[model samples]
Every structure is written in structure tokens, then in C-alpha cells.
Target: MFSHIILGARDLAALAAFYDPVLAALGLQRMPDEDDGGPAGVGWQLPGQRLPQFFVQLPFNGQPASAGNGTQVSFLAASREQVDAAWAAALAAGGVDEGAPGVRPRYAADYYGAYCRDPEGNKLCVVCWG
Candidate 1:
């Protein structure tokens, strides 16, 4: 039951470019918003809804953005193949690999996932349970 998520980045434009294909592989798109303006923040919606957006931006306090060591944002994939594609897209976009796409048995037998860090070190995972 989350409404939205905003990921802070040091370079907003680069972050957006890096995430474009990664999210597109999961069928999400960058949502258009003219009012949420402040720096280069952009929101990506979950296909249909306008709210519950995901944003990447520089810090609102005008400080350098830092990644939380324990924080991770995850995107759901419709299938394991999409998870692999997402991982490849991330790496192609200059992301560092945290974990390759595979079934993480520790999480679940069907928990297929891939982990990576964005250019600014934000951790993310593309996972599939179905």
C-alpha cells in the first residue's frame, strides 16, 4: 500500500537516462508532471495510474544525494525473463551488478531476481514471483 517513491540522485538527467530502458523493460513509463518541478526530478508511473509515482531527483534540501546502505527499491517483473532483461538493461546503462539474475532460494523457490546499484549507488532489484 505505498503511494509513491522518490530516489535521490547526484545527476538527475543521467539517472533518468540510466533508468529509462530498465523500467521500460518492465513496462513502466516516465510520468509527466509539470508541478512537481524542482531540479530535474521525473516521475515514472505504473502504466495506468497517475499517482503512486516513482521519481529520481537531486535532494530537495540541495545537498548531495547519498544512497542508504540498507535501503533498496524493487520493481516487480511479470516473468523471470523480464528480470534478466531488466538486469541487462541496468548494466548496459552503467549500473554495477550486485547479484545476477537467478532464483534466490533464500527468499523463495520461485523468487527470481537481479540486483544492481545505479550510478549514484542506489540499490535496486528486479524480481519475479510468478
Candidate 2:
């Protein structure tokens, strides 16, 4: 339902470092740099697909980037293992844990998810629904 989701970042390189491995765990690959022409940022999408991209970039308004309260970006994971891998990768890449990987029955019986804040403080969730 999204053409793209862009998170404003103060440092593009640092944000890329955190997202690269985390998205890779969820089966996303970085889009070619040549495709990201509008802003100084990096984008990721499912391999061979063009839409539904996720990007981290410097603010377009020439202001400092700030995380929005009560805002989050969630990615789908293929399995519980992928959720774990993504969460582990996030933490290892300087993300802060919001919730550890586990079954979240409140969402669904087989909902497994992990939550974290990116290095730029953008909240993210990786979830698997079995």
C-alpha cells in the first residue's frame, strides 16, 4: 500500500549502515545508487522489484532530521528466524532494542516480531505472521 517510505536522517551513511544488514535479513536488497537521484540517501527493495521502497535520507527541507513520536516503520519477515536475524542485525548495527524477538499473541497467535529504533531513532518492527 506504499509507494515508498522515507525516514529523515541526519547522517545518511550511518543510517545505511544500520538498515543494510537489517533489511537484508528480511530479504531486501539495496537499490542501485544511480536510482536514488532525488536526495542524498539509500533505498532498499525486494530484489528485482521496483516499487515499495524504503529510504533513509537527509531532510528535504534543509532542516535537522527528527524522529516523530508514535511513528514506526514495520517490515515483513518470512519466518521467526528471519525476525530474529533482523533484530540481531539491527542491534549489532547500533540500533536500540524496543522489544526482543518473540511471539506477540496480542497481535496474533503466530505473530512473531522484534522492535528497535534505528541509529537515527526511527522506530522499526520486523514481524512474521505464520
Candidate 3:
């Protein structure tokens, strides 16, 4: 029911740097060689997906990293190791730790999840289901 998921950012470059590795760990490769310079300044595709390939474009009007409240993105990790790696990387890359990586026995005995706010305060999560 959705065409594509595009987010407004204050800086496409920084956002890409933040997103690329985390998504890649999930087997999503950054689409290469596609820049149109339109409102959607650039695009990155996750090849061979069930739905439309995902893309990230520059915010047409305002600055990049304009993520607002009520916005959250979750990337799945293959194992708890990945979740820990993601959390560490995010912290090094200017993300604020929202929740530490560990099993949330309250949520579920094996619900391992890590949460952080991106440079723009968007709630991003890396979760592992063991």
C-alpha cells in the first residue's frame, strides 16, 4: 500500500553513514549510482526484496536529520552479537543510547533489543530474537 519509504534529513551524507552499515548487517546493500538531484536528492536500493526497494533522499525544504517525534525505525539483527555491534556503532556515530543491549525479560525471556536516537532524534532499534 506504500510506494516507498523516504525520510527527510538535515544531511543525507550523515544519515547514509548512520543507516548504511546497520542495514547492511541485515543483508540490505546500499543501492549504487543513482542520484537524480530532485526533491528526493538520492536513492539507495535494497536489492531482491519482497516489497519496493528502500531509498533515502535529501529533504527538499529544510535541513537534513529532521526526524520528528513519533518516528522510529527498527533494523533486525541476525544474532545478539549483531545487536551489540549495532549499538556500539551507533554510539560511536553520534547516536544517543535509549536502551542498552540485553535481554528484556519483561518483554520476553529472549527479547534482546537495543534502542537509540539517531542524530535527528529518531528512535532506532536493533533487535534480536533468540
Q: Give me the candidate number with maximum TM-score.
A: 2
For model 3, how does the per-residue alpha-carbon lDDT over 24-47 read when each residue is reduced to its tens digit?
A: 655667765544667644444457
Estimated TM-score for each candidate: 0.93, 0.95, 0.76
Q: Which RMSD does model 1 reach against the true structure?
A: 1.3
Q: Rate residue 39 of model 3 by lDDT.
A: 60
> What overall lDDT goes with each candidate model?
0.90, 0.92, 0.73
lDDT of 1 by residue, 77-97 (tens): 999989999999999999999
Backbone clashes counted, model 1? 0
If ranked by TM-score, best first, what sequence of candidates would result? 2, 1, 3
Native-to-model Cα distance after best TM-score fit, residue 78 in candidate 3, in Å? 1.2
Most lDDT-accurate candidate? 2
Model 2 stretches astray by more than 4 angstroms? 35-37
